[model samples]
Target: MASTLNTQLHSISFAAFILQEIMGNPREDETPQSRLKQVGMMSVLYIMHQGHQPLTISNLVEITKLTRMGVSEVIEPLIARGMLTETFVKNSMGRGKARQFAISEEIFEKLQSFQMR
Candidate 1:
């Protein structure tokens, strides 16, 4: 009985090893579309998750460590695609207004589906 149990344990361990090898390390794809969405989504999520407040372009730039141009590039496409909604907020600093960006639920759902596949 002990020998049989030992054999079964080894078989289970071997199966786990095989499964890990087959699965490899799951990494996000760096395709252009995926990369854009990833940066945008992560930046949005980080702000929402951390700040629990509205997000501005400057907020996104700070959170994502992306340049103003980079953030604008990603945001323009998202706006054109209707994947995000933007609202202008009065800047307390009194220099210029800021735009708060939110991801549309429709786009969020689509991204979730894409990640599942």
Candidate 2:
């Protein structure tokens, strides 16, 4: 019971920290698109933090209920920021390979330290 509660608390705080970093300073000219982007980024980060396995874009789209394009948009930025790492999955039965994403090791370590606070 205690372990479950601690895990829940860590997840919640981890999500909050991600939101704070993504939201940064609010501007007077915030628009619907900007807000949606922020939420999408946060959702991706939160999911990556909680999941032990790397995920494909299709998996993220299904989990977050975001469109394929929306997930792609957020994921690119996360990758560029060094917050996420992308690895290719070989498709033995298919023509093309799929990319898998996971939280970067540095960021994951930081998250663990943050949760301890």
Candidate 3:
């Protein structure tokens, strides 16, 4: 019972932290498109954050319900921010497939701090 409660609490707090980061008090000049982009990126980060596998754009699109273009817009900026990095790998057919992305260690550490506070 205690373990279940702890798990639920952790989930709630983590979701709140993610929301606070992505939806941070909206700015006066922030446009709907810009806000959507931010939310899209945060949704990708939150899903890919499990650290199980380097997730591909298709995976994020399917999970987050965002269009390919939308994911592309946000992912590029996240990479620029150094919070995410990609690794390209060829498939069995030796064709260049979409790259996979993982949260940088620095970003993961920052998330840990959010968990703490």
TM-score per prediction, in order, is 0.50, 0.70, 0.61
Ranking by lDDT: 2, 3, 1
Off by over 4 Å in 2: 25-32, 35-38, 48-54, 92-94
Candidate 2, run of 10 with poorest lDDT: 22-31
Instruction: Supply the global lDDT for candidate 3.
Output: 0.66
lDDT of 3 by residue, 9-93 (tens): 6556655654565467555655667756765565556656654644777777787788988678777755765657888876435
lDDT of 3 at 83: 55
Model 1: per-residue Cα lDDT at residue 74: 64
lDDT against the true structure, each candidate: 0.57, 0.69, 0.66
Per-residue lDDT tens digits for candidate 2, residues 1-117, read: 999998787777667765665566444555556645755665665666566545787777777798988788767756765667899886445778988877667855877897778
- Give the top-scoring candidate (lDDT): 2
Q: Distance (Å) between predicted and true CA of 49, model 2?
A: 5.9
Error of 3 at 69 (Å): 2.7
**Backbone atom clashes (below 3 Å) for every candidate:** 0, 0, 0
User: Which is the winner by lDDT between candidate 2 and candidate 3?
Assistant: 2
| Worst 10-residue lDDT window, candidate 3 | 18-27
Candidate 1, 20-81: lDDT as tens digits: 42234323433456444544454464446345756677877777798987777667655554
